[model samples]
Target: MRKLLICILSAVLLFFQARAQENIQLKSGDLIFQNLDCGPLCDAINAVTQGYQGNKFSHMGMVLLRNDSVLIIEASGKNVHLTPLKTFLSKSAHPHYVGRLKPAYQKLIPTALAFSMAQMGVLYDDQYLYNNGKYYCSELIYDAFKAANKNKPFFKLFPMTYKEPGSGAYFPVWKVYFEHLNMEVPEGKPGCNPGGISLSDKIDILGQYK
Candidate 1:
């Protein structure tokens, strides 16, 4: 009897959730509307979060919401948080670093993406926190990038700076994964960096090179 009651309750909860999703009117081409492919998406999400370790970085999860006009990307993480749009402009120390498109990027990009990437970078380059000798991949990325503060969106979130690796590939690809986007760093140059804006080439940067 207890088991049967539990199953009934679970079904009821699922029914409500499905109803809620149905009510969330979405735009025509938003990915969430297509098919719920949790398999690949979950793996991708795991990659990004695992990218950080040590030096105090947050663990963030992505949430996608679709509206009549736009797609929203909400982030929920351990230390990182979502600052309300109104409060963000005035309350945030680095307002310039905040993303304007936070509400519309949950599918591929979360609102706190830049900061998350910073954390990922730290993990990719472990040497930065070797002295501490106790860190994870994602935590290191957060510590290192937060220290550098070179990338406005990412830097504003990080309070301090640390030694950083010279390459984007240092961190786990899944967390800071850039699918179908081109990031040309000015530092590397020509053969190495080849700086240029992405035209429309969809490529995942986080894949393991080896």
Candidate 2:
């Protein structure tokens, strides 16, 4: 009876351990979003945009698991590059969340990842414009899926707004950014943002991690 009870207890521990691992396991092509709390720029982004699942993500990346290691393909200050998942999560101020394309759209994963890999080393788009040689965080995802869909974009682009949520005036941070670039804020321009894509019907909220 003693031996039998010990075996049962061991089985219970193993079952819970497996369950915990499964919850943290991330599949390739999963989207991870975070609020980095980097500075005023991050603050401005979260203020003007919306998020799904009650999150306020200001940045995002695509998951890529290779040779038993997990990496994220993201466009950051250094441009589009692959970052280890552990390093990626460490940069977030709050717990980051994952989003996955619905099963019906899962078939596009390979093509999208391939396209994203091909874009490694591309410059980060500080101007946040479309069709430029550079790419911002969500723009990389949008373009990759668009390429995968043969230019028939799976995600939709909404006219961008830099104005405060209810106020007609543009965010002060935006004004300074564009002025430094010596260009006008591309208001009403067709583009994609992380917050907007998080609410996409094509994706379902997977889970989050700290």
Candidate 3:
């Protein structure tokens, strides 16, 4: 009886362990969104843009499993690059969430990933302009999927606004940013942002992690 009870307990433990592992396993092409609290710059972005599901995520990346390791393809800082998934999550100020394309769109994953891989080392778009030979985070996703869809974009680009919600004036930080760049703010320019893409109905929320 003692041996039987021990075996039953071990089985229960193994079952729970497997469940935990399944919960965290990420598939290739999953989208990870996070709010990175890098400093005042990130705060400025969160202040201006609204996010979906009550999350004010300021950054995003696409997941890829290469050679048994999970990696994130993101356009950040100076260029588009690959980052380890663990390290990517560590940079988030809020818990990150994973989103996946709906079942009907699953067939596009390989093509999208291939497009993203081809964009490796592309310059990051600090100006956040469309067709500028540089890409911001969400723009990378937009372009990748667009290519996958043979130039028919899966996501739509809306005219960007840098103003605080309900206020007609631009955010003070945006003014500063443009001043630093010695260029006018591209207000009303067609572009994509992480917050907007997070709201897309084509994706299903998979999980959240801190």
Candidate 4:
């Protein structure tokens, strides 16, 4: 009985959310950026990077417009999976931003989404390393577009930094995180983060998704 009530509640919530977002006009393959308020780790992430117009973002996901429902494809939790747009929005407390590809690059959306779909169950890359057979949020988006562009880089990658800006000292959160994993911080490793990708010239920022 409890499970049935939960299902009914979920349906009602989705119905209202759909109506609320009626005018969003989002398209498939839109790059959605979110400011995650997930404590020190997220704080460290924002401290080291800057998003479009200097906004700080800690997470990202891609939009998948399927019929009347809007979903988000992201490498989060234990695997890569699709989440309802409502669910994705609710996960972050800060405003979410959307980026749509310019007309010239719209053709790549299908291939990019197709690549993402094929990676449905890949494990999350908590280590934040490139090509280690796992997918982190931004890395999944990076590789999907790269695959769409025939394995060419559709997005740029840079050496990752885990240090506090201007201090050149490693953030304490990252220090303990890597230490717990028995690995040194992978600084200088090739990586692509949400903040960096938000500044790409290939897409035009459509402002806040809300």
What's the CA RMSD for each of the models? Answer: 17.6, 6.1, 6.1, 9.2
RMSD of 3: 6.1
Could you give candidate 2's per-residue lDDT for residues 1-210 as a string of tens digits?
999999999999978755654687688999998888878888878887888865788899999999999999999987899999889988966878788999999989999999999999999999999988999999999999998888898888989888888899998989999999999999999898888889999998866655
Q: What are the runs in model 3 whose C-alpha is more than 4 Å off?
A: 1-22
Models 1 onward score TM values of: 0.24, 0.87, 0.86, 0.88
Worst 10 residues of 2 by lDDT: 16-25
Q: Name the top lDDT candidate.
A: 4
**Worst 10-residue stretch by lDDT in candidate 1?**
191-200
Candidate 1 error regions (>4 Å):
27-210
TM-score of 3: 0.86
Q: Tell me model 3's lDDT, rounded to 2 decimals.
A: 0.87
For residues 1-210, what per-residue lDDT tens digits would candidate 4 score against the true structure?
Answer: 999999999999978766654556799999999998899999999888999999998889999988889999999889999999999999887778889989998999999999999999999999999999999999999999999998999999999999988998999999999999899899999999999999999999876766
Those runs of model 2 whose alpha carbons end farther than 4 Å from true positions after fitting are: 1-22
Clashing pairs in 3: none
- The global Cα lDDT (0 to 1) of model 2 is 0.89
What is the per-residue lDDT of model 3 for residues 1-210, given as tens digits with 9 covering 90 to 100?
Answer: 999999999999978755654596688999998898877777777876666777788899999999989999999989999999889988865768788999999899999999999999999999989999999999999999998888898988999878777878888888999899999999999998788888898998765754
TM-score of 1: 0.24
Against the hidden true structure, what lDDT does model 1 obtain? Answer: 0.27
